[model samples]
Target: MILLLSLSFKNTPQKIREYFAFGDEEKKRLLLALCNEEPIDEAAILVTCNRTEIYISTHIENTNTLISLILKNCEDIIGMDIEHVRDYILCYTKRGAVSHLYKVSAGLDSMLIGEDQILGQVKDTIEFARECNTAHLYLNTLFRDAVTQAKKIKTETLISKSGVSTATLALRVAKDELSGFEGKKLLIIGASGKIGNIVLKNALSYDFSHIYVTKRSHNIDMSPNVRDRISIIEYNDRYQYIKDADVIISATSGPHFTLTKEHIKDNWDTESKKIFVDLAVPCDIDERIGSLDGASYYNMDDMKKYAVENNEKKKLSIEKANEMVKEGVEKFLKWELFQENWKVFSDATKSLEKEIARIGEKKTLEHLFYKIRDNGSLEALQSLIDTLSN
Candidate 1:
C-alpha cells in the first residue's frame, strides 16, 4: 500500500510548516530513518518552502499507525510534537496518493499555480531518494511518471508561460515598491543557495545600478554575461551593506534569522524606501523589521496575494492543466494495473509454451483455431494472438 503525508501551504500556515522544512542533508537523513522502519518498504520525501511531502510504500495497511510512525520520526528529527501538527497533515492512500503527486508535479497543487520550480524540485527530490537508496521500484516509477506528465503539461500548455517563481515575485514587488530597479542597489544574502541563486539570476535582468551578494565560504560561479555585474560580499559584512541597498532579499536554509531588527535598527536609513524579502521556509528576516520606518518586509506568506492574482488570471490554464493531470493519473493507474498482473500473465504464458512444446505448435494452433471457429470469433482469437506475440 502506498501512502502520502503532506503538510503544505494549502492547509498549514508557515509558522507550522517551517518546523517540517529540511535541508538536503536533513532530508536524506529523514529518508534513511523512514526506510529503516520495519513497516516502511520504500520512501521518498519532497521538501520545499511551500510543503513537505512524504511518500511511502508500506506493508502495513493501517493508516493511523503509519501516520503516527511518520509523525513520531519527524518529531525525533525536528523536535516537534506529533499531536500538535496531526490535524494539519493531509493523508492520501493508493490512487489518491498517485493523483496528488501528479497534480503536485504539474504545479496544480502549488501556492502559485503554474509556477515552474515545483517540477524541478520534485525531480531533485526523487533523485535524492534514489541516491539514498530509499526509493525502489514503486516510488521510482511513480516519480518518473509524475515528472513525465509535468513536462508534457509545461510543453503543451501555457500554464508556466511566464516562468514566475518566488524569486521573480520578490523582484517584481521590489521593483514596484521602488518605482523600478533603475539607479538602485540590491543585496542578496545566502546567494550561493537555491533561492538566493534564483534571486541573483532574476536580479540580473533588472536595471539595478549595483547588485551585491553574500557568500560564506563557497565560491559562486556566475555566467560570463553577469560575472562582472555582481559583487560578492562576505556573509559577515552583510550588515554593513544593508543601509545602501534599496532591495534586500535573504533566502537560506538556516534556522535563525539572516537579518534581525536589532542588527538593522541603528543602520537603517529611515528616509529612504527599501524592500526586504525573505523567501526561506523558516524565514530569514525578522518580522519586526516591517515596522521599521521606510522599510517594507515580505515573506513567503506575503507572496500569497500575488499568487492568488496569478491563479485567477490563469484559471483556464489551470482547468486545462487539471484535466491533463487527470488523464495522466488514469494512464499511470492503468500501467500500475498492468504491472500488478504481469506475473500472472507471465506464468500463464510459460504454461502455454510448455503445452505447445508437448503437442507441437502446429497441432496446438490447429486445435485453438478449431475451438475459436466453433464457439468464439476468429477475429478475437487473432487479436489475442497478436497481443501475446507483441
Candidate 2:
C-alpha cells in the first residue's frame, strides 16, 4: 500500500503548516530513519514553504504505526500533541496518494495554482529520497511519471501562463499604485527567496533606479541583467531603509515578523506613498503596520485575491491540465498492473529453470561418472566433459 500524509496551505493554517515543514537535511535524515525502522519499506518527503508531505509504501496492516511514526517526528519541530496534529493532517492511501503526487507535481495543488516552481520541488523530493537510499522501484517510477506528465501539461496547456503568481501580483499592485515607476527606490526585505526573485525579475522591466535587496549576509547572486539595478544591504539596516522607500516587498521565512509596528516609528514621515507586500505565510510584516498613515499592506491573502481575479482566463487551460492528470493516472495504473504481472511471471520463470536443471541432472550423470575412470588428457572430450564426481 502507498500512503501520503500532508500539511498543506489548503485546509491548514500557516502556524500548523510550519510544524510539518522540514529543511533539506532534516528531510533526508527522517527518510533514512523511517526506512530503517519497521512498517515503512520506502519513503519520500516533500518539504516546501507552503507544504510538507511524506509518501511511503508499506503493508496496509502497519498503517497506524506508520502514521504515529510521522506524527512523533513532527513533535520535534512543533512540540504538539498527537491528537492536535491529527486535526491538521490530511492523508491519502493507494490511488489517492498516487493522484495527489500527480497534482502536486503539475503545480495544481500549489498555493499559486500552476506555478512552475513546484515541478522542480517535486524533482528535488525524488532526488532527496534517492540520495538517502530510501526510494525503491515504486517511488522512482512514480516520480519519473509525475515529472513527465507535468512537463506535458506545461507544454500542452496554458495553465501556468494564464495565472498570476503572488510574486507577479505584488509587482502589479505597485505598478497600479505608483504614478511613475522610473527612478522609484524599491526595498525588497527578503530578496533571495523564490518569490522574491520573481518579484525582482518583474520589477526589473519597470526600470527602478535603485533596488535595495536585503538578505542575512547582504550577499546575492544575480544574472547580468538583474545585477545592474540592485544593491545588497544588511538585514539589520532594513528599518532605516524602510522609511526611505516607495515600495517594500517582504517575503522572508522568519518564524516571527521581520518588519513590525516598531519598524515604522510614530514620528517618521508616513506621507510618502509606501506599499508593503508580505509574501511570507506567517507574514513577515506585522498586520498592524497597515494602520500607519499613507501605508498600504498586502499579505498572502491579499496577493492571492489579485491572483484569483485573473482565474477566469485560465479556466480552459485548467481543464486541459486536469485531463492530462487523468490520462497520466491511467498510465500509472497500467504501470502498477505491470509490476504485479511481473511478479507472477518471475515466479513461473524461476520454477521452469529449476525443473529444467533437475531433468538435465537425472538423464546423464551416473554413466559419465563410471566411464571417466582414469582420464589422462580430458581436453579431447572437453565439450562432453563434466565434473561427474568429487
Candidate 3:
C-alpha cells in the first residue's frame, strides 16, 4: 500500500504552511524517521516553500495507525494539533498517490502553476532520497516517470511562455511597497544565491542609485556592466552598511538571522523607510527587527498574497498541459500494472524453461526476456496471465 500525506498552500493558509516548511536537512531526517518505523517499508520526503509531502509504501493495509503515528510525532515538526493537521493535510492512497506526485512534478499543483522551479525541486528531492538510501524501487520509478512527464509537459505545451515565477513575485511585492527606486540604496545579502540572482536581475530595471551586494565570494558569471553597478561588501561587514541602505534583501544560506535589531543604529530616525526582504527558509532577517520604528518586513509567505494578485492565467496552455498530464498518468498506470504482472511472468517463464531444459535445451533468462518482450502483445500477455492463474 502506498500513501501520501500533503500539507500545501491549496488547503492551508500561508502562515499555517510556514510552520510545516522544512529545510533540506530536516527533510532528510523526516525520511529517515519514516523508513525506521514499523510497516513503513520505504519512504521519500518532498519539501518546498509551498508544500511538504511524505510518500510512503507500507505492508499495513490499514493506514489509521500510520496516520495516528504521523500526527502524534510530527506535531513538533509542523506545530499544529492533530485535528488541525487533519484539516489542512490531504491524504492520498495508491493511484491517488501516483496522480498527486505527477501533478506536482508537472507544476500543476504549484502555488504559481506552470512555474519551472518545482520540477528541479522534485529532482533534488529524489536525489536527496537516494542519498538518504530511502529511495526504493517504487519511489525511484515514480519520481523518474514523474520527471519524464514534467519534461514532456514543458516540451509539448506553452504554459511556461509567460513565466511569472516566485522570484518575480518577490520583486513585485517589493515594488508595490516602495513606489519608486530612484536614489534608493539597496543592499542584497547572499548576492550569489538563487533568489538573490533573480533579485539582482529584476532590480536592473529599477532606478536605484546603488546596489550593495554581500556574498561569500564574487559572482563570476556576471556581465561587466552589471558587475560595475554592484559594489561587493564583505560578508561580515554587511551590518556596517545597514544605516546607508534604503532596502535590504536577505536570502542567505545562514541558519541564523543576518539582520537583527542590533544592526539598526538609529531608532527609525532615518530619512527614508527601510524595507527588509527575508527569502531564506529559516529566515535570514530577525522577526524582532520588524518591531523597529519605521521598517517593513516581508518573507516568502508574506509575498504570496501579492504573488496571487499579479498572477496571470494561461487557460489554453494550462489545458494543454493538463491533457499531457492525463496521458502521463495513464502511462504510469500501465507501467505499474506491467510491474505487478512481472512476478507472475517471471515464475511462469522459469517453469517453462526448466521443462525445456529437462529435454536437453538450454537458454538464459535474458533470452527468455527478449523472446517474451519481442513478441509480447495483449493476447500473449493475457495468455501468460491465464497460464499463471492455471
The model with the greatest lDDT is 1
Between prediction 1 and prediction 2, the one with superior lDDT is 1
The TM-score, computed over Cα atoms with residue i paired to residue i, of candidate 2 is 0.80
Best TM-score among the predictions, by candidate number: 1
- Cα displacement (angstroms), candidate 3, residue 384, comes to 15
Per-candidate Cα RMSD to the true structure, in Å, reads: 4.0, 11.6, 6.1
Q: What is the lDDT of residue 96 in candidate 1?
A: 97
TM of each candidate vs. truth: 0.88, 0.80, 0.80
True-structure lDDT of candidate 3: 0.77
Alpha-carbon RMSD, candidate 3 = 6.1
Overlapping backbone residue pairs in candidate 1 total 0
Better candidate number, 1 or 3, judged by TM-score: 1
Q: Between the candidate structures 1 and 3, which one is better when assessed by lDDT? A: 1
What is the lDDT of every predicted structure here? 0.88, 0.78, 0.77
